[model samples]
Target: MSDRQAYSGMAVTGIDAKGRAAIPAFLRAALDRNGAESRVIIAESANAPCLIGFDPAYLEANRAKYGSRADARLDAGETVDANAARLAFALNDIASYDSSGRFVLPPFPAMKAGLDKTGPVLFAGLGDTFEIWNPELLEADAKVHPAFKERALFCLSQWKKGGKG
Candidate 1:
């Protein structure tokens, strides 16, 4: 990713009364440049306590890992596609940005992530995608996550070194 395109900072934003939050201009530009303007997917994060929001192009590009777990289930001889469906749609929500470049989070996805009208949120950039977090959850993570600063520094060092880290 180019310096301008790289998602590397945090933006503490809030949900409006209409259930929308402005995606930082940097992220919005990157998404538009990558042709991800059509849809934004919001869902409960499988890896953390927060929510993750990313465009479909990223999803499509990482299909083997992000888009499908059905193959594994089939190999395990699962009787139905319940697990696969759960993996795919358990927190799945399809959204679109408004005229102001703000994404609309539906009720289910918003509530699942503990975001409601007037909730405090954090927009954390994770390179290819970004994560939307509840401030409380983010603070909780910071307290318990021992290597947060070291990991952050390491990423900066790697970025400076021109390694795709």
Candidate 2:
């Protein structure tokens, strides 16, 4: 149950009208391997137009790393906006899933990621964290990997056909 366990793989699931979606079994296994609780932290990705999900342990590690960097900057006589740092880290929202891996998406973060109430949500694993994407948005993103875009397109087709995706 090391916190170093990595997340890998992709899954597509639907978000109901209540914004509830299931975490794919593969990603859930990775979280379990890391000794994570049923809760996960969801946040908007700074580098992409998607939401990122990770365990609390990883969130703490990120906070510690950012704190160290800010301290270093302060020690170097550089100006650091304490307020901005807090706000930046405050973007994360905690979500608790049931044993079946179903959880309600936080509205703000979901909306920020362009996720609608009902549609296919693609969960793509990225080692330390996973990305939650709106399949259509992902398919239209030119900066996304070709393979990912392809997968998104496939998911979109399945969703349109009334499949689980």
What is the per-residue lDDT of model 2 for residues 28-76, given as tens digits with 9 covering 90 to 100?
A: 9877777678988898988888999998888788788888988999899
CA shift at 57, candidate 2, in angstroms? 0.5
List the global CA lDDT of all models: 0.66, 0.85
Which residue pairs overlap in candidate 1's backbone? Answer: none
TM-score, prediction 2: 0.89
Query: Where is the poorest 10-residue window by lDDT in model 2?
Result: 1-10
List per-candidate RMSD values in Å: 7.7, 2.2
Question: Which residue pairs show collisions in model 2?
Answer: none
For model 1, residues 18-127, the per-residue Cα lDDT tens digits are: 88887766667776776766567777877776778777766665556643455666678855546655676655777888655787877876787778767556667788
The per-candidate count of clashes, in order, stands at 0, 0
On a 0 to 100 scale, what is the lDDT of residue 65 in model 1? 64
Model 1's TM-score against the true structure: 0.70
Which candidate gets the maximum lDDT versus the true structure?
2
How do all models score by TM-score? 0.70, 0.89
